[model samples]
Target chain A: MRTAIIGAGQAGRRTAELLRGLDAEREILLLGEETEPPYDRPPLSKEVLLGEERPRGLMQRAAEVYEAQRIALRLGEKVTRIDLGAARLETAAGECIAYDSLVIATGARARGLRIPGADDPRVLTLRSIADARALRARLRTGLRLVVAGAGLIGLEVAAAAIQLGCAVTVLEMGERAMARCVPEAVSARIEAWHRAAGVVLEFGCPLTAIRPQPDAIHLVTGKGEVSADLLLVAVGAIPNMELALDAGIAVDDGILTDADGRTSHPHVFAAGEVARIWQRGAGRHVRFETWQVAQHQPVAVANALCGEQKPYAELPWHWTDQYGRNVQILGTHSAALEWLEREDGGRLIYFGVDPEERVHSAVLIDNGREATPLRRIIAAEKPIQRNRLLDPSVALRQLC
Target chain B: MAWHDVAPEGEFEMDVPKVVQVGEDRVAVFRLADGFYAISDVCTHEYALLSDGFCEEGKIECPLHQACFDIRSGKALDEPAEVDLAIYPTRIDGGVVQFQL
Candidate 1:
């Protein structure tokens, strides 16, 4: 049987790994748009942006591992078309490949600033390794950086830039940082962390235009004009679902998939940021562009492809590092969440509860040890006992 | 390698990892439901005191990046950290916790 995975990101790499494990002799082809092999994206802002490390360490495995496993990695090959009926894919290189099972893991693409001069060469986004390589070259001590958003990527890049001795300023359209992802309370706290570290955050402001100059880049904002040596548009990311949509596969916010990652077309599946798996807790299909979900969803997809069925119901979680504190979000992060903050000695844990106290999520900052058990509670959606969850004397594992 | 006594058994709390200086190395000694195991006190992802990190279910999540490490085996459990921690041979002698450096 031949299984073809399109994308070559974490999801594609994971699907290839699982397929090899399930059947040693199955033919597998992994296609990626970028020339580079599958590498981790989380460190692009942290390690590679800071010029502290190259992306080599973030690779799924050494290049030789692919040959050893008999997995063909067709790098720099973008799958331009997918014919679900024929179970075939056409690449940019004008090569057509047929497969018994196909996975659309095309991941996400960075959202661009559609304002005037937005296409200027000085303006960049932090999505691909190429972007990171160029950004790293231009970033130096005394370089002024104006980030367009205070979301995860923007704030992370701001922190990394500050560490590299660059003058950093972050602009956000929302009233607080990560407003869509975390509760207001969490946003305000993290905002303080950013400001305290000498990073300037201008909230309620959005970039209107970017004008390139010989010496500096001029950015027009709601407040006034600002000139900086570098500009990064980190508004957010949109799922790359065009290939699936063009091929007549279902798509909502992302490519629609059943619990087992089976798309609308039989013999075709989806995973990672590109797949909107059915979420039981939310009672709707939702897509999460998180590192944790991208690393895990392939297991269920591979199981179903191999005739071993298992629903994809893993509780979503992802962690981010900023300045010196490590913040972990378990289950979900939503604006509608009501959090109950607990202080155990010096550690802080926020439990996201609904009106009836049904636990929905939890954010643990500088206390990731609480994550493992907290994940179990969030996955079960158990009723919250405020006192028990608040008491650090009581281990979170025992509470569940 | 030589074993050096760091702390008494009573000094450690159940499931709470403590960082103890053993000559030139800082080690995090964990007291689990079973016994004790030791790993490097430094997080491989970044420079952070692993003593201040969270420990549960025989794993320590780095306070800076949340990179988890299995205390028993010292294997890195997730992203942002791919390097396995250096786990030292540990044993308790006469109510004292000791680790081989």
Candidate 2:
């Protein structure tokens, strides 16, 4: 079989490796748009921003690994279009590659700012190794950094800049930081930590425009106008679904796929940030943008190729390390539910319940100790008493 | 055979692990439904103390990175942990817990 995998990120690399391992006789081609090899994206806002590690350190596999696996890696090549009827992919370099099976892992790109001076040289977005390198080169002490959006990436960049003695300010239009992933209490804790680390937070504020100045950029916001040496826009990301949409495949927020990573079209599959998978537990189609999901979904896709249909239904878990603190979040938290906090204040486990107070999901903060046990409890659907659940004297194991 | 008493069994009702000094090594004693088991307190993966972790069934979960280990066999359960812990014989006579190292 001739297989062509697009994107060359974690999901693309995993699919290529699995295809090579499953069928040695098959010809595999891994195409990446970036000039460099596959590198970890999570570190772009952390280690790369802090200047603690280089972009080369984040490569998933060395060059020799691809050579030894006999996988043809085509770098700096962009796929212009997918010829679905002919079963071929046309590249920008005017090369057409025939493939029996194709994996679409085009991933996502940062949402660009659309203000007046959006294209100014001082405005930046962190998505690839090149973006990180460019941002790092411009970072200097006493430089003012205005970070739009207080999401994970924005907060991380703010923290790193503050640590490097830069005057950093974060602007979030939302009521609280990390509003999508964490509870308000957890957000409050993180906000406090960031304040202690010298990051100025501008919540409930929106950026109206950016005007380039002689030495700095002027940010026009609802609160006030601010000047900064660099402007970082980390609002969110948009999935790269143009190719998939053009190919007439289903796309809602992302490319819609079954649990086995199979798209609507036979012989075409999707994974990574670009794939919107049917989440059985959540009973909805959800898209995940985490390294764990990218690493895990390829196995299911490979199994599906072998005639075994297995759905990917693992609990969504992710961790972020910022300002010397390890923050981990598991499951999902709803604001309507009651909060049960541990006595030590080090752990906060939010319980999601229905009208009858039946536990549906749990969101734990900084308490990896209870993660495995909580997973089992969530699976068992055991009824837990409200008072007993909040008792710090009682071990979490006893609740099980 | 010298059996030094470490902690009372009731102390483990709230949490399984109770750190105790046995000879020169610091050991963590866990109380499960079956019985009490003791192992080295320090995590083989990092400098985290095993006694501060969450215990469920027969496994001790690392508080730092969530690496789980079987309390009896001292074998690591998953990734991020490549080394196994050293297990020591533990027993409970009456209400007192003792370790045989």
Best by DockQ: 1
Pairs of colliding residues, candidate 1:
none
DockQ of 2: 0.26
Question: For residues B1-101, what per-residue lDDT tens digits would candidate 1 score against the true structure?
Answer: 88888789999888677777867789988888888899998878667777777676788887655678899898999755778899998888998999988
A1-400 per-residue lDDT for model 2 (tens digits): 7888889988888888877778788788899999887776877887787785553325456767898999898899999999899999999999999999888999999998788999999999989888988898888899999999998889989888898889999999888988888777778988998999988999999999998989888999989999999999999999999999999999999999999999999899997889999988788888988776777788777767656776788777776667766666666656766655564476667666555555656666656677676676666677788777777777666666
Q: For model 1, how does the per-residue alpha-carbon lDDT over A327-382 read when each residue is reduced to its tens digit?
A: 88877777576788888775788898887777788888878667767777776767
Give interface RMSD for all predictions: 3.7, 5.5
- Among all windows of 10 consecutive residues in model 2 chain A, the one with the lowest summed lDDT is A52-61
TM-score result, candidate 1 = 0.93
The DockQ score of candidate 1 comes to 0.45
What is the DockQ for all candidates, taken in turn?
0.45, 0.26
RMSD of each: 2.4, 4.9
